[model samples]
Target chain A: MLEATIDASLLKDSIESLSVLVDEARVHISPEGIGVKAVDPANVAMVSFELQADAFDEYQAEESEIGLDLTRVLDILGVAEKTDKVKMKLEEDSRKLSISIGGISYTLTLLDPSTIRAEPRIPQLELPAEIVVNGKGFSRTIKAAEKISDHMSMGVEGETFFLEAEGDTDRMRQEMPRDELISITPGPARSLFSLDYLSDIAKPASKSNEVTLQIGNDFPIKINFEIAGGRGKVGYLLAPRIESE
Target chain B: MLEATIDASLLKDSIESLSVLVDEARVHISPEGIGVKAVDPANVAMVSFELQADAFDEYQAEESEIGLDLTRVLDILGVAEKTDKVKMKLEEDSRKLSISIGGISYTLTLLDPSTIRAEPRIPQLELPAEIVVNGKGFSRTIKAAEKISDHMSMGVEGETFFLEAEGDTDRMRQEMPRDELISITPGPARSLFSLDYLSDIAKPASKSNEVTLQIGNDFPIKINFEIAGGRGKVGYLLAPRIESE
Candidate 1:
């Protein structure tokens, strides 16, 4: 059994982030919070999201695993205004999820959790270099880089963190010294990543005030940020694409 | 010869309205104002746009017809900030039009006016039914109708003017009475128009505060609106698609 009410905009953004990798998700819900972890079909990226119970106006659950079609939920939520509050409920016997926003209720059938691929285990890594900055600044760089190439490199050198993308005709480099960013611990680490995945990951993170990045040489880089006024946290990991030179 | 300076945003919006119909245009420049009249490739819609001399900070020109690739200009103008002032100049000897906005100056090669289709004479239309309302409201109705069907009916009966679209399974309608509109001259006229043209025309008109529409039985309807602080006027004419039985 589960019932909850939350900001429509936050829920929409969360679902959009999940929808980036998978069409459906089996989210673990309990009295404490809701969490989801999944890897892309290509196995090049992993997405993890969590929202504390405090994120909702009112929450009630008994450690249930709810399977939902994120795309369908996103479509229903698209009609909601930013300030609208969405009330969601999962009955004990019904296979449908009832979502109500501003007098409009949508009954969406649930997906089969058994049909979904098993959740991915969170990998433990020791990344030495870290860089933190405003999400907008990072997202802007990603967008600008896309105009030049489909891949970019993020690296730390001395007291500066840099992102660069190069094409046959043009190259764009964005460098921010320690003083220009929220924080930076230079560790002489560098890795090349596909901009396609980074660009999508940056979209939701861009809405946040700060995005913390953890990087290492030729390893998966972690992009983490908070939403729902800090009541929720999202982390994205993308494996590097080593150059064939 | 011609040289003019205007608000970048005003120029952008005007170009966008033109782009909706055709990629190239032959604009007649005079001391009074600038005007362009062209029909879409499908021959279903014609657009006429003009901005008075007062719309620009500076204006000077001899009677001349200059051809331009509006799509290219729009792409260059995409870089301009709204408040930026754009200076434009054309020389009698050169086949290029130079537009300077902010610190960037773009020289665009012009298409030969002789290569473009001959200008069409403005048809002396006698539309009886007239309705004036918020452009945004009308555009919203058009967008909603698009979801239902590809064609819609517009007509006046009693005191209300109605727009309705019907799909295979769903239908949508918007109706407004004389008192609800800016003004309405009730006439027993009705016509069916291709939503494809009306929806595109409504996009730019929707930005205006008021749109004046004139309609007649099974004939073409005229859509008129003003922009750039009322310094410019736009008129769109769309031929009606006669309904069969």
Candidate 2:
């Protein structure tokens, strides 16, 4: 059982972070907070999201896991004003979620957790380099890269972090030194990633003030950021596309 | 020959005023200003547009008629910021229009005026009633009506101007008494129009401060609004859809 009241935008942004990777997600609700880990159908990208109980004005829950159809929730939230407070309550007997905003109440049928694909084990890797940059600038770089190629390379050299994309006839690149970035732990790190995943992930990251990136040679890159005014956290892992010489 | 430089937004908005009704149009350029009059393919609606010379920062031209593919111009303008200065010049010998924004230059081939449809003759309609209202409010009313039906009715009764739409199961109405409107010349006037035309026309109309509407029973409706800080004017005439009763 779960009951909570939170800002509409907070919940909407949290759901959007995970929805960028998967249509359906298994959400774990507890007295501490709400958590969701989902992988895209192609298994090329994964998203892990967590919202602390402090993010909500009121919160109460028993340890429980439920499946959610993110698209449907987004549709309902679309009608809510950003400043409005959203109230959500789960009916254990009916297996439905009751969401109310203003005077409108929407009853959404919940999906069964057992029917969803089992959550994958998150791999642990000690990536050698870490870079913390302004989310807006990083998002802009990814958007500009999209015009040049389907895939782009990110690397750290000395005190600078660089992102570059190359096409047959066009190229784009952006570099930020340690002085320009929020922070940097430069090392030997470079990897190529598909714009498809970076572009979707950028939408949510753009709203954050600081986004952290961990990279290693030819290894999956991890992106981490905070949402809901630093009360919530979101992380994304994208498999790199190895260049063919 | 013509050579002119103007704010990108002013030119874009003026062209948009006419493009909403037709994809291509015959433009008349003179030292006085620029003018265009065209009817949609179905000949159900017609648009008249004008941008005075004073609206441009630099203006020079000879009396000339050119066929413009509005889609192409809008595409080029899409890359320009609203504040950017757009320079346009006609090359009579090459039958092309040279448009420059910032450092980018695009030479667009002009269509042969004779190959395009002949300009339509705007019928002189003596509508008995006139209502002047806030463009934003009028635009909002039209948008709300769209949610109910494909057609909407406008009429004046005594001191109030009323706009309404009705569907099989839903209806919407917005009434502005003389006190609420900027001005009103009330009389026996009512007409029904298709939303397809009003919705498109509303795109540019919504930006104006005041919009004037003239109506007559079962007759075409005339809508007039200004652009470019009143330096430009646009008028539209749409045939009414007679109720099948």
Candidate 3:
């Protein structure tokens, strides 16, 4: 017997919005946190998601777990009539998860949890620099970069934050000074990452008016947002392109 | 003179798809059929499209015939983007007819065409006695219905044709006679109509392998199919539904 209440519609919407970017659905769940790790097929980019369990209305499980085949769960949730309370029952066989709402019943078979790869520990970074900006401003800045190039270069100096994209035929640049920045107190650092992945994940994060970004030299960029008063974090590790001159 | 060739992506895809559902758009052109129409806002769905005429290798316009908004163009082509050969040019200020691949471009702007309404004229029917079946089977039977249900519905005394729909909960039925009853005999006089419309309209027609149908009462009971084929022909329609109750 499993009982929990959440804004399933909101959660489903966020997942659907993020799935468009990467694959290999692996989400991490621990007593303290829940996270997701997905690397694009090319392996050039990886999106690591971490959310504190406090965000859930009631997250109860005798044992912490990770689940795969999220697509089926997503489909089942999508077909739900609305964002009403959803109840999930794990049959004794432990092979299927039955999801029910009002009267609709959808049973989704689960893969062996053991078969999924373990989430790798993201290496800690020592480099210095972080900036907090209005989530809307950051999302808008990345969306603008899409028109110029698929990749974006970001940097910080003192209080100013910068986003830049340059291609042979086109170029785009947006700068938000400390005063204009939602909240910024910067150290010196810079990095470049794919605008496609950033834009895609930014979709769910955009719901919040503000977000905090932690940046470092050539290291994974961490973006944190608040959802339901609980912290929702997305760590985007993008491999820097080596220019051959 | 501004002349450049776009690959014909947008116009070709949009017009071909739209023409299947909508009949016309407003921007008046010299001819009667070439102009496009807008889909009803409430009933019409949105499709994201972006293509520049410059992408093509050849583009020539002596003058601007019609400058249309994206929404207006989308509605005119009810179902948009069937094939890729969309070509456009302005002739006289009053007329602009762009030739699409499947059919000739006609010019006429629908007056308040955005209003969703039932088709003006229901086809006349003289069909008698109809049968119900699953959509897939109907689709398949129509293929054969062309040959069998053609001029015959072998009554209880007839050899080939018979109708049946079974059970209170599990509804399933089939009618296929063994002998020439499946062949030709105009004496029985079943019904006559093109399968083109069924081939075009009907969204639910494709969802189930079997489409539950009601046949011949007054007019043909419509069997809507998920739209297929580039031309936008009805996937399935039976005139018998009209005469049989």
| Top model number, TM-score | 1
Candidate 2 chain B least-lDDT 10 residues: B100-109
DockQ scores of all models, one per candidate: 0.04, 0.04, 0.03
Please provide, for model 1 over B74-113, each residue's C-alpha lDDT reduced to its tens digit, 9 standing for 90 to 100: 8898899979999999967648888999988888788888
**Candidate with better lDDT, 1 vs 2:** 2
How are the candidates ranked when ordered by lDDT, highest leading?
Answer: 2, 1, 3
Q: Write the per-residue lDDT of candidate 2 for residues A207-235, one digit (tens) a residue.
A: 98899999999999999999878888999
Tens-place lDDT digits, model 3, residues B1-245: 22332334434443444444444433323321122333333332211111233344465433223434445555545443544444444434333444343354635332442343323333444444333334544444333322212222213224344433222211112345444232322223333233344433323344344333323433344332222222222222344323232
Could you give candidate 2's per-residue lDDT for residues B1-245 as a string of tens digits? 89999999988888889889888888999999999888899989999888999999999999998989887678657756668898898996637787766544456678878777888889999999999988889889999999999999999988899998999999998888989999999889989999999999999998988999999898999999988788889999999999866
What is each predicted model's overall lDDT from 0 to 1?
A: 0.86, 0.88, 0.49
**Which residues of candidate 3, in runs, are more than 4 Å off?**
A17-21, A28-34, A50-54, A57-59, A64-66, A243-245, B1-245
Best by lDDT: 2
TM-score of 2: 0.55
Interface RMSD, per-candidate values to 1 decimal: 7.5, 8.7, 14.0
- Given candidate 2, what's the lDDT at residue B204? 90
Local lDDT at A57 for model 2: 98
Q: What digit string (tens of lDDT, one per residue) describes model 1 on residues A168-188?
A: 899999989989999988886
Model 2 spans > 4 angstroms off: B1-245
